[model samples]
Target: MTLPTITVDLLDSKAKQTQKRQLAKSLTKVLSETLGYPDKEITIIFKST
Candidate 1:
């Protein structure tokens, strides 16, 4: 299924790759509950701008 765009803007800090991955996962969970969608089914794009 096609999902809507997900955009998050924040200041660029000293976040590592693993930490970013975890943040992405957590965001997915939040999205699932907020958007009524499963994390596995949603396509997410994480951008820092």
Candidate 2:
């Protein structure tokens, strides 16, 4: 199965590392459960500008 690539772009440049990590984790869990995607196979890329 081809895993989906999830990219999250943050407009706030001051976002903390912990916050970003938490967001990624939350997104991963939701996607995995809702989309039946494996947590390990899911890819999340975060970009801050």
Candidate 3:
């Protein structure tokens, strides 16, 4: 099966590194649990808008 890549766009241009890490971790955890996918298989990409 192909892995899933989740793209997240942040509205805040000054988002901190700590906040991004936390957001990525939380998104990965929730997505993995809800979608039954492995943590390593889920990809989270953050882009500043």
Candidate 4:
């Protein structure tokens, strides 16, 4: 089975962990609905520089 992977880069000065999680969750939900994929098949990765 193929899985979807999302990579998010944090370049903002006010990036928070809670926001990151919410963003990931929202992205996952949108992707799942738009792409007709399952939530378990989606992967979200967050990177901070």
lDDT against the true structure, per candidate, is 0.74, 0.89, 0.91, 0.89
lDDT of 4 at 12: 55
TM-score of 4: 0.85
- Comparing 2 and 3 by lDDT, which wins? 3
lDDT of 3 by residue, 1-49 (tens): 8998899888867888998899899999999999999999999999988
Q: Give the clashing residue pairs of candidate 3, or none.
A: none
Measured by TM-score, how close is model 1 to the native structure? Answer: 0.61
If scored against the real structure, what TM-score would every candidate get? Answer: 0.61, 0.86, 0.86, 0.85
Per-residue C-alpha lDDT of model 1 across residues 1-49, encoded as one tens digit per residue: 5775566555776777788788888888888999898777766665665
Query: For residues 11-40, could you state the per-residue lDDT of candidate 4 as single tens digits?
Result: 754778898889999999999999999998
> Model 2 clash tally?
0
With candidate 3 superimposed using the best TM-score fit, by how many Å does residue 25's alpha carbon deviate from the native?
0.3
Model 1: lDDT equals 0.74
Off by over 4 Å in 2: none
Better of 3 and 4 by lDDT: 3
Where in model 3 is the C-alpha error above 4 Å?
A: none
How far out, in Å, is residue 13 in model 4? 4.3
lDDT of 2 by residue, 1-49 (tens): 6787899888867889998899889999999999998899989999877
lDDT (0-100) at residue 40 of candidate 4?
A: 88
Alpha-carbon runs more than 4 Å astray in model 4: none
